[model samples]
Target: MAHLRDQPAGVDGITIDWDAPIRVSDGTVLRADVFRPTEPGDYPVILAMGPYGKGLHLADGYPANWRRMHEAYPEVAHGSTGRYQNWEMADPEKWVPDGYVCVRVDSRGSGRSPGFLDVLTALQARDLYECIEWAGQQEWSNGKVGLLGISYFAANQWQVAALRPPHLAAICVWEGFADHYREGARHGGIACEFVKGAQARQMFTVQYGMGSRGPTDRNTGRPVAGDVDLDDDVLRQNRRDLYAELLARPVNGEFYQERSADLSRIEVPLLSAGNWGGMGLHTRGNVEGFLAAGSELKWLEMHGDTHFNPFYNDRGLGLQKQFFGTFLKGEQNGWLDRPPVELLVRHPGERFEPRFEQEWPIARTEWTEFHLCPETMELRTSPGASGTLSYQPEHEDLRFRLPPAGHDREFTGPAAAKLRISSATADADLFLSLRLYDPQGTEVTFIGSNDPKVPIALGWLRASHRRLDTDRSEPYRPVHSHDSIELLVPGEPVDVDIEIWPTSIVVPAGYVLELGIGGRDYSNQGTEIENAMYPTTGVGPFIHTDPEDRPAEIFGGAVTLHFGPDVTSYLLLPAIPAP
Candidate 1:
């Protein structure tokens, strides 16, 4: 057993219990660090469990994100020493001072915990359930526990909350994806490489057994990984190959089901904070999860900015504290009186206006359809005369543009595209982008989760995997059944519906809206910004470029857009009428 050390109260009036043991169901001990108020009375607990090392400081593990966040929003580090800040987890300095106990646990096989490492699986969720129960039973705990964090820390909450542990009271999921198949590994049946990159840079570096090879926590002067040093081969044998497993399981089967959250089973009070800029990875899950969750008391708050910034900022922290205070601490904070939906409505020039609403898709939304006119490459209110447009899938794309708007229009909900198309080969990959152009014809882009220049919305689909799940499909959000593949015969046009993830954009008068369809990922032709982990090429690391997934023989071919009286292709947008 490792020696447990309890540090004296610091200048900030917080005490720390280091290397605390939390034994799970299998009797394997997981490690955690507990921070609580020194004045000591039982306090409501806020817990986070994930693969990221609990000992690794945010400044040390993710320097780029830490530097960028502090540089842009200095308030993120305000009111705290910033020494206890971990990636995506609550800063203990901030929470402990507010009379909340903050506990950070290293999941099995990562950080200081020693065990086989397979993340986001049923086992991981079970471990989290045990941890929550453990926190509740602790003498220093007030018998109520709340879950709070961003991204990985947030994503796991949905799964664990379904277990309904006695201690689990509420959750604040900030920018987390609930679906492992659709949102994390694959997007519209296309293999996304983001998982691969994430595993390499985020997980592998601080993996358990790295010992001397891994970084040390500056605060404790101890290795972030365990003390026992292990060879590279031994380390490789301990962790699962996430990328290989994703490639092996291309469909949403038992593998994905075991990892994804059962939204229907989540009954705890939920506050899902989503980012408008997190289109490919984080956006869809938050909106869809909030709607599907069985929780009667749930709220959705949407904002725009870099993914990590909002979670730590005043707006994000305020919402989290209010919700947790009401549910976990039993405070009469009037949280129940707040509206169910809160939106930081986005507009041109990086401006966001805060608006309270009754429900998502805004009850007053006007579902408008803009039909495609292939002859002139225009989007019209009604279908035009029959015409056809073809483009080389490998080299070109078909773009249809809407004329300058007569008045400012707000598109604040879900969007989709219905197209009639054919391929020269048996299979073709379709990449769709919803874009806005200024009066001068310059493309309008916004800061995304990782990329600085992302378009209005993006969607993707492989022709062979275009089968829709009728029971779950909506006109605006088409859910695809990627279990089966149906090849397309040459020159035979077929109708396919593609779901463009939810987006919020207020288009000013004289601005043009365009729909671009291509065989490859959409690029804005803007200079790429290199980040700490990956290069930001308009879409960030959420790219699909695996050669095995898109073999040239099957996916590389000429694609045609058939626009005729019988074959009508159009873009459906959620248009909000003027109040």
Candidate 2:
């Protein structure tokens, strides 16, 4: 194996090898660079293996991500010089001083390694197992290993941890989803628009030298780090394009299970952190992983703000250090004695108020039911005096408005809408938005998983695909089985319950809570805002929309909101207690 040399300067007590080749299964020599204590007899290793090249410097590897982190939370650069910053992973400078070995590996066939690159499939998990075992046996390692990373890295950690590598002690999954088919790549039986652009902008473009790994490195001046012999065809065959591939298998097929982490098999201590703002990819995973994983010593923390900010902020870093110290270092930090769940309830204008709770949904949460009155198209706390309501696609997407009381309203946890509808057509697409309208009747929109324009929190379900997994269903979350599609009769009103993914908001007294039922995605509601673009990945912010699979004739029909007469539609809200 060819060994890469280290830079002379050291940070704290650590020295780093700029580029080192790590051999994986099947004789593939992938690359990783390590930062370890100089006086190391042995130290618990904090390892992250991903598509991001290990040799690539953060200043050069992810200039856009680096710039954004510093701009949002300037304190990241407070104590030390920023040299080892990388995407969605810990800064080596922060960990080395604590006597931890930080190793970053470029996944096989990515970055300097010559082979094929597949993202989070079974092949990648096998390579990760090997990496874990390899780290345990290294001279610099004390044989205990833990995993930490965000997004891509965090997703893979779940997969490999399920394999139960002997040396793998604990894991911190920061906003990583457990079910690939349901949350990531595809949602509501449709492929994600974000992954479609991500492939060209983030994956192959950087691998093939089309994006910000640039034409060459400014510092090394070598042909950037992982420029290999791969072209479009090789990239195509080796890695499955998540967006297109997921579209083919709309059902919960074998493909989804192959990549999904079996939470039942994950037995190590887990710290699952989620962001309130992460709607599509991450929000479900963190909450689901904590609730489902077999780990007896598991904890959950929820925060708000941009996806990447919470991981490095003082609050995030402090929690990370405390958890890792307890599990990895075997310290008596009392972390295990802490509450099982904590939430940073977010207020308007980027304010977060932390609340330590014993369990999710908070025991004191009032599961308030807001019924949808069809005649007035308003949400009310009481069941309507009239019968059920009916609505159809051609009808202006039904909007229900309800005014807040004299006091402000605070809501947290998952939301659900129960609807009774009769569609003239066989199938209907259910698009529900939990919206907030100002006193002037203007819709309030915030940053969403996709759609830079106006977007209130959204939920979707197909009428035919409305079967629930009765065993796992909860009042706040309706767990869809996605097994069979039950076509509705022409004139019969049927009850359909829709799961609105978790959300947090503080509604002022003047604002009104509104729910919109429509057929297709809402895109043109507001002007698009230009968020920061990812320089290294070349992918902009995540974008999502209802794809073309839902034809107008099949989904769009004359629906009747059978209210005032008999049918009743209602929205379920998890109302939080006032502080």
Candidate 3:
């Protein structure tokens, strides 16, 4: 194996162990790239486990991301060689110099590993737990292990942590989803196209396919998959029909439960980091995980951004190191005394100022609701003209907003909406957005996970997935059962509670808060940024018009919003009082 971390003298270097073997309980051998201080004693291990190829460099695999990242944060190149950076995983270029051993493992049937490839399944989580145990027993390990990474790497932390591997000391789930069906593949029972798009652009590149051999790692001078190729039938059998399988499990049940984490079972020291703009996939998980995890020493940190920025940047790394340092290194850093919730309150022009709070839905929140008045198209404290507005899927939408001027206030924590609505057809897909506007009526949007012009926050619900469990449901954050579908009877008015994901935006005085109920994603009139992996539009690949999920007959219909005394509809916002 070839080693990196070579160059100038007198500079501390890293020892790279390429294609390191990690044996799971079932005898499957996964591959990993280990990076640690060349002059290392035993170091606490920071492991990132996922299907992402460990051998691929961020620059080569995700060129658009590399360009965007370096352009935005040039400091990321400070004090290190950029040769060891991988996509969505811990950068050895940064962590290795800081005396931490960073391990990036390629799960079974990925990269150089040989076995079946099924992502986010219980089997993968089991393999992850075993790998953690193996890492702890390694000669270069200090018997303490922490999980840290973004997206896929972060998502799996919740899964394996639930397994309670003895070696798993701490987890920093940065921008991850807890529920597979709800927050991931399907939202409110409607299929998300991102699952299909992301898998093709990300996973298909390195998947062990027949008649093909994967790329070679430039640093290691070895084939990424070691010439692993099988018959077409065999390769087909090894990989999963990811999208089709998700379609089969239309609702959250055994299929989703197996992939989802039981937050109560995750009792390890936790630092669930969130991205305020990651409404589509990452926001809800971090919010819910922080609230539901059984861990006593848990903290939540919400930041602003494009999903990957914070992880490698000073803001995110600082919080992660503090959390892992205390639990993994046993260093008594002042991490414990820090507030339970650390939020970066968002403002216009991508401004995010840090705000520390003791709890989410900050104790001083005014649970305010803005009722919908159809005629004036206004969001009023008191109901106005009682009428119904028609909605055509992806063709038309309605908007409601506060007065032209108001107090400068901060809306933090989760939000929800109660809609008195009916569909011309038996089913309708509900898309809600909490937005901001300048006094001049110009729409204000924020940068979301993959979308550059995303709204403040968004929530989706299929009319059928509207059943809420009283035990778990809260006023501002309503939790849907999603266990069964409750179809709407034709032409009947139903009160549906749509749980808008957590968001934080500081409204300037004279500015306004607006809510948009749409049949489709909120489109941006602005230009789109091009990314190597995704089409950089307002919604990224998280589109909702899968023919199987939203058939022409069911989703193509007229929907109506009713407003009156008996059928009250409103937007529940967490108005945090200014301190």
Model 3 scores worst on lDDT over the 10 consecutive residues at: 1-10
Question: lDDT of each model, Cα atoms only?
Answer: 0.89, 0.73, 0.82
| Global CA lDDT computed for model 3 | 0.82
Runs in model 1 deviating more than 4 A are 1-7, 526-531
In candidate 3, what are the lDDT values of residues 1-579, reduced to their tens digit?
224333332245777777788877788888887887888488899998777677778887877778888788887777666777888877776777777889888888877788888899999999999889988988889999999989889889999999999999999999999989888888877888887877766776676542136665667655555455676677678888788888888878888889889889988999988888887798999988899899998999998878778887776777788788899888899998898988999998899888898987798899998888887888888877777888787787888888754567888889999998899888889998888889788888887777777788888989888889789899888888888887778789898999999999989989888888978876777445555456655676678877888886887788989877777788888888777
Question: Model 1 residue 385 lDDT?
Answer: 73
TM-score of each model, in listed order = 0.98, 0.89, 0.96
Q: Give residue 205's error in model 2 in angstroms.
A: 1.7
Looking at model 2, report the run of 10 residues with the lowest lDDT sum.
534-543
Candidate 2 per-residue lDDT over residues 1-579, each given as its tens digit: 223233454546677664566677688886677888888578999999887655456666556556766888998887657666766778888888888989888787566555666678798899889888888999988898989988778888889989999999999999888888777865665455766666665566546332343444343344433655455565567665676677677678788888889888999899999876677676888988888889999999987666677888877889988998998899998897899998877655556678788887777889999887655667788766665445556456878888657778889888898887778777777777777767787766554322223343667777787888899998679988876668878777778888887777788778888888876554443433334442111112333344365566666667765654355567999898886
lDDT of 1: 0.89
Q: Write the per-residue lDDT of candidate 1 for residues 312-359, one digit (tens) a residue.
A: 888778889999999988999999999999999999778999999999
